[model samples]
Target: MPADQLTDLLDPARWDPLPHPPAMEYPLPVRRRDPRTLPPAPATGSAPEVLSRGADGVLLRLRHRAPRARAVALHASGWWRPQPADALDLVPAGDGWWEIVLEAPADWRTSYGFVEHDGPGDPPWWEAGLKAPGAPVHPDALCAHRHGAARGGAERSVLSLPFDGLFRAGRDDAETPAEVHELPLGPDAPRVRWWVPEEAGPAPLPLLVVTDGAEHVEQLGTPERLRRGVEAGVLPPLVAVFVDAGEHRGDVLGVPGGQARWIPEDLVPRLRAAGLTAPGGRRLALTDDPARTIITGASYGGLTALFTAARAPGTIGIAIAQSVSLWRYPRGALVGPLREAAGYAPLRLRLHAGRFEGSMAADARALADALDGSGAEVTLDLHSGGHDWAWWQPALLHDLAAELGR
Candidate 1:
């Protein structure tokens, strides 16, 4: 398509915006739910408990008294990476109470939840309880240190191991309210949210476009991270545009055709119209310079971030793709072709995936290596965690600071 036609195709007022595409399939680690029927565990209580171990370890004990559960397993961040293990399995005790004691690093701060399997041929139940088809399950509500809802519809229990001054521990130091706007991408297109630093100067700010806007804000605490980074002098002032995934997130983020074009061509203009980049506005300067703009996301959104940068070369300077879906099983696979492509735009990139992400981690490394061969300044980090928010939150802060910090 001609560049002019591509730009016209994304004119939200003239277009209904493309419908979200189908979901991509990737190999997520199979969780191990022991099929043995064990006696009920002792009834300790309903609330979560944490105790300090010797200097570096923290003991985490959880109790659940589900009578029909054959085995109760705990799912925390970084626990189920690489392969399935019985370490998180709660030991059966007493008549109905089941418990699992985990000795974790003292610096751990992540969310968790329980899965109760009813033996073979039965599905497991999450802490969100039972719900009708298509209903949302709030995972944060189930946690002992519940903050708010998380991404992907469900929530998890939070665990902040005893640590002082850890980067991602506890609540955000401050909060900034965001302005929400509906773009004309499609009738069903999700609304995007805009956020500026609470205390920015008159200078024009760089633009940071985040895919999966709602999840990043409500679940992963993106605004708070931005706030903390700015307050700590780790990041420059930037205007953030958060795009929502809606029900068709899989289609929207998984495919590059629609979302890739819509963001820079369509949504960005809308931002400008809102006086975000106007001379006397919030001063979000839209530019063709790659260093002044960043696009970021996780999982399928991560894949979209890379696709967006690749598709809109001069438009997006930095791409932060966290836990990108690089596998082939899903609809949008980029590594193979990206490796073979002769030329690419001069885009600085940061790629992150959990070390426990199994094949996905390998894919991230492969993509980074290919980018390196292509002479792209790419930073690939395989952190010590799973494809969970526990890892993505910290990765976002680190990437933003590394890419745009002054």
Candidate 2:
């Protein structure tokens, strides 16, 4: 049952909780663009304003005008689907302008757009208001930056709320260079990127395995952060291995044994042969003391990190999960077994979740409590943020310091 639980968790189809946005749902009802009914982009659009901040969330006011719209609504990535309750009715603010005010978490940063509808049955008119030329598509781009296809094959806008959390800035001046390695898991396997802190001296370095390797390296600045951490002595020198999920990320990182097999059977051997050390200059081994190995990730990646620690106890001594999807199906499959694994290997964990992530946040805390007497050391923290990179980027930095500083 325990082994099956791990395999069940690895089932990719079961992992993703949020469906792709409506815009991404292709073959959308086609309607001829009626110039009279088409919304003429918003004018004088800067960014939404933070009208007020309170205990619940932040109140935001966004102004635009769709002369033809009988109804308007706000849509964002986090919501499962754009609900009628999320609809924003345009109120005449004068001079052909209308405004809609919505409340969002203080740390919410995501792609969004204002959709206009002509009638009850009319198809939605997607409009990303006038963005400054080369301004990176504003007021609606889905994120500050996007990778792969924009959701829905339709361009939305970007909305980033103000956050004052402390995230150490990465250093670009470090002489250490990052390297990319290929893991031949077939032609479709995720690409690999790594950085070995030779600067940590002759001793073999510890290893930090990051899921979602490509984005963390390119978008989230993982390599730069590692470089900065080593040079600043904030974290001990370590070999950082980033795993890319490619198209099958859901199958690879989201599922339970997906990462377990790849890391131990595939990644570890490759790193060992490449002269990457697991403490004491020894080749990487699951049977090693385990304390020297760390696996970390956010969201589904976070979920996988915990499973990896349990599935390959001798290989991973520590797991750092950020905003993990504990609220998903087979919800407590991993947690339940971890609590009952009588001879489970000694492991340490650092968990970080967002106060705004609702149930997932609560689940993370509960997960930590569940592990209290299970022979694993655990720490859970709730930061004022959301499920996006804006929160995880800095949180990862802090998690590293906590683990490698030991």
Candidate 3:
């Protein structure tokens, strides 16, 4: 079945509704537009319009004006993977317009794009891999809200709905912002971007070690959010360390190999030795207690966070893993180690997975079930979106507020 059709199998009634924004209509009426006339393509940088809303979800019409293309397909994160058969076909409407209407939860958010195929039977460029040469995905010209550059600097378009309070902690206007510092550890090590909260005191603060540092900082604006979160008193004052994975991300991130050794063994010691100091010349220190140390990441980075916690419980005690690629390893392979670690010492974990993530969502549930009775304080948050940074950013802020709230 096509990716859009597969979504029809999901009953939104099964999932609880996300908190609604103030004075919003329960079921929004269809916009006033002529049925015969196609809605004009949104201006560049503007989001695609929500056509209508119903009890099931919202109706979003994705349009591509590709007159010469043989076929056009919608490629949204979590909706369509590498499989060509799963591609959401956009039917020819009128003129040069090719469009498809998607029914999604009101709180749904994701990055998407359209692909123009040479032939009807052509496979998606992503089948070869995002980094493959000539596999660039075309961003939606209409929708301007982009998230994360991939496939040789090609950014994906964003579609965000109202999800109240999920990102409320990060205020745009803040009196005091956290100070950011770049630390080049060595030629062999990943560069670290450190965020030291202005509220830093004499006492050692909790540390948050984030994997895929560049994406978290550049794409997600996590440091700014963390600063806002601290200033608002929604989160406790702490130090954030963003670890740049570079090209070797695939080699060292998720796999229980180099990252397992480097984080606790090399990175932590080096940071301690450097003695991070705030802009005010107040010497900032990191807590030695594992319970005060938190590690987080998304996708493969998420898997790495859990793996690192299990391997070095004495170094990391809390893990906030989002959209973890638990399917990477053989079934029960990663879970076994975490279960063993929990038996020795209790670990606090926040596991997030999207309902649209298919097998990854199942794997997250399985991991949560396996951790039961293992003495780990685990909370599983099944969100309404996909495996995109659109959800990951707000979800990260939500986790920080819940876990380390003042």
Candidate 4:
């Protein structure tokens, strides 16, 4: 696509309502439930149902039943401050069913919801409370699977395809789970959740520091995934620290701030004081070497991961930034400084982004290109899907294994 065309694609204003594609384009399999029998046979069946699978991709049918609704729209993650015009409006099926068929990759997963407009005129765009005069977004009542709760305490519906991966599934019955502990740094600082291997040998282990700790723990099940990787020999036994930012996430992780420095300056020193850095102190020990220390996060946290590593390469050597918000800064603003810093200490970076994330995806590619051969070992992995945790959780596991398994 041309640059102009790509810009238009990214612009939500250009996204008009769409109708379901022709049957020939997305041929429904005979074994699958037909669109006419929708709301599923049992009536309580979960959605968005998989209509068909083909060489191209899978066809997903997302539906909502609102008998008196004037309009309905679909809202997915990564769309910030979404307006009704920015969303995909669903067409009326029959009775009161409104639905849209989407084509997605086999491994795609995302959190989505439906907006029902009942009032006169245009529906209001979503606000913090979703209390705008016109419409409010609601999770798919028919879909049992749900993602994390948003600002208004409303959970979004999850649409996930079959994925054959170590991290997506829960731990096996026989595998020993990683021991989780809480570390309080001070009243002013956020608490940290630590995960130590159950059978950590008496040797210094690699460390992974994750930002946006609470969400990764509660929503993504990251610690368990890490535990699974270690037991399966896909990753080395290690210590992982999840740093909770709480309400101060934007102040700390969004930019270069004092609280952001706590990870390298205060947190590491405190962990050492607890005898986590050397062997023979307890069940598990962590490496003091920055080369074995990896820091990772997504979105704004992702931007912070790169910033933290660049600022303190001696404390953090590897950075795995997933779906980074490089656009938060001016275009290429971070590239020059990052390149200069890497030229001095040389950092290893793994940049991951989704091809569906518009300019964010382009920015990741641009950052990778700008950092090339600048004394930094940089690798960029572009995956299918959007900025939802559905992709970030599994991608983080793969990154950890790739970086630490060797």
Candidate 5:
């Protein structure tokens, strides 16, 4: 009756076909006696090697042990004012540190660190390691520093159209929403699996589309989180589209042209023909202008969110990238799209990574630096844990109220 071909929606291996660093489920503070920040990479500990640089920006190698704190603010102290750029981001190793790039004037001084209301759960941001005897926390802020690292590159809009052939759906049929559905790209095509939420009733509802599919659901427990966002008004009552990854995730995500086809040739048309996508419609171009639509994932999935926005600027609005592994593809795949990307119809991005996600920080910072350089409306947060979910959950809820609603 309702696509019997779709079943076994929670298969992790089947969903997250690409390899993305794993992340924690929440962010809890680690009570350390001596609070000190790790000085500089090339100076104190091992910093990643610099790969290449151009007028666009410098591309530094990533150090798996780098330390990047969570929920930092670029305040008056000069945290991000001493570099060739004006922002920073991280790739978490979930180990002892995270990879990040500092952007500000070569000569600058400022204070910053993790920020959170001193209350119930855990402070939103905490400086894990700092050692400038009397280094002084913002007291009102975090930590201060003189001089920022040189960073950033050319800015551009990317149309994320990775299509080795890949990748949502409906509300009205949701009265008792089908938990799983097998959607064929065409009338006589190979059927791919689509996991629908158990939410009932069709009515108009927002949507959350996940690329890594099952792994996102299991590791991040997104279904539960989305359910909560809905109930709490952090997000509109929404329908979720969990697409199980087929062999081509990287192939599709690593390239751009293919992406457009996947959605146009395969994903989008199918949803429209099925009559499931009414609110967000069949593609990014058709999504709501003011309505909140979020697309996210870890590693490749995270990368795809950036790609998706580049591909269909006005289609979707909010994007969350967790431990996005940009290096998994080529710099151009990300850069080229971002450079040419347009239609910045008020899109928002939330990026997160464990303090130690390894070489992947290159991937993390590239996007963050790009977003900040372009002056795109974006927010970046980091946590103590490495690429694990224990940390991802906190970033999700912290911004829930802001992104979803009241």
Candidate 6:
């Protein structure tokens, strides 16, 4: 193609200004339509070998077939929204490949794509091969790894808690279940919130006490999916308690993650109080059925789930960690700790991450591998997306169905 025509192809208005590719390209159809509290993210890395990131840019080594394009210049649009700017680094070497890095400001989010160029602009301008199907066509939602397909065919939801402050725990009374009554904690109480499933038919519904309760509703689509899946038969009815993590999510969800107070005293007693009173009662208390119990969350919520599972063996049988914020904490590498934890106690886990969202996929894969090798039932889902609700929701729904539903 002539340079002029190629330039025409490279025109900003030439392509659809949507966040992602079209419907045919939409990998997770259900996710594309919902309104989430958390918006899309900016660019991370591209290429391989370097390392993708949850941070602004992702780094990778590219081995594209073209040798001349090795000296490729990079240009992007839709990242953070409304304009075009520099977003990638392409440095080629003798190995017939180049090292490419893609970046955007942390809060700058929206749809974006890259074009390959020669000098400042190339002769045969071509796509950088980084968009996905079913991605929004508007710049409002452009982001890398929007649907990295970290986990596919599963459904997910994101609920936003419009408030932030000291979290309060509340429960319902039998006479008047309408009111959400506040509960009490000891001297130094850990914030807690109680969950009453829409329909509770079985005894000892498995329990999952998630840290950063408010954030789960804010960042991840947990409540909606949990309710819908139970109603739709996709997942079994399980009791979930989102413990109020408040501002200390960093400290609480990390080393101790607030398990001492949250689990041993607060959680168990509450479930016992809510006791199995229906018909011929079974001894299956909410906190009793370990195998049926699963602790889940994303990011810090994710790390907390893993930490809780690691510390409390036979108590929390399942761990659902999505885009785990492992590097944030001391000894943040969760795999080694999990490996040791698994030795003392057995656990089943569903770990997943994508290439574009930091080193999530790689790190989680290593952890899953280690646990699986140690005789734990582990499923490793490496998707084509990043660290966003777009991928997390579907990944958890599908992977959990395989690991826990059956």
Residue 334, candidate 3: alpha-carbon lDDT? 62
| Every model: Cα RMSD to truth | 7.4, 9.0, 11.6, 10.1, 17.9, 19.8
User: Once superposed on the true structure, which residue ranges of model 3 sit more than 4 Å away at CA?
Assistant: 1-45, 54-56, 64-71, 81-99, 117-136, 162-179, 269-274
Candidate numbers, best TM-score first, in rank order: 4, 3, 1, 2, 6, 5
Q: Could you give candidate 5's per-residue lDDT for residues 35-154 as a string of tens digits?
A: 124334452432223333344334432333323343222222112121212123243435544444432221111222222132343322223222111122322211111111111111
lDDT by residue (tens digit), candidate 6, 191-232: 655444556665567666566565444334355556556667
The TM-score obtained by model 4 is 0.76
**What is the clash tally of candidate 3?**
1
Q: Tell me which residue pairs clash in candidate 4.
A: none
User: What is the TM-score of each predicted model, taking all chains together?
Assistant: 0.69, 0.63, 0.75, 0.76, 0.47, 0.52
Model 4 scores a C-alpha lDDT of 0.69
List, residue by residue over 42-62, the lDDT tens digit for candidate 2: 454455666677875776776
Best by lDDT: 4
- 1-406 per-residue lDDT for model 1 (tens digits): 3344433333334422244344322223432233233333234333455643677565555666667777666665555421333445567765766776556555555556666676574333232222211122223322444433344456565565533222362244244444343335567556777777757766656788988887766665667667767878888777888888777766677565557668876776565555453224545544445677888888888877876766665567678888887662343245433332214346677888875555677878877875667645678877655566666766676777777853
Better of 2 and 6 by lDDT: 2
- Model 3, 1-406: lDDT tens digits are 2322222222223222233223211112222223235565544434466778777678677778788776677766665433334235667766877777656678777767777766555545435322221234667877645655343445777677755342521223233334578877778877788997776787888888988888767665578777767777888888899998888776777766556558876787666666687776778878887787888888878988887777666678889999887666556666656766666565888899987665667888888988888888898988766667777778777787777753
Top candidate on TM-score is 4
Q: What is the lDDT of residue 320 in candidate 3?
A: 92
lDDT of each: 0.60, 0.59, 0.68, 0.69, 0.41, 0.46
lDDT of 4 by residue, 193-284 (tens): 88876678878888889998877666556787887788788988888899887876666774654344678768875675564532345755
lDDT of 2 at 271: 64
Cα lDDT of model 6 overall? 0.46
**Which wins on TM-score, candidate 1 or candidate 4?**
4
Is 2 or 4 the stronger prediction by TM-score?
4
After superposition, candidate 4 runs with Cα above 4 Å error: 1-45, 65-70, 78-87, 91-98, 121-134, 149-153, 162-164, 169-179, 277-282
Clashes of 1: 11
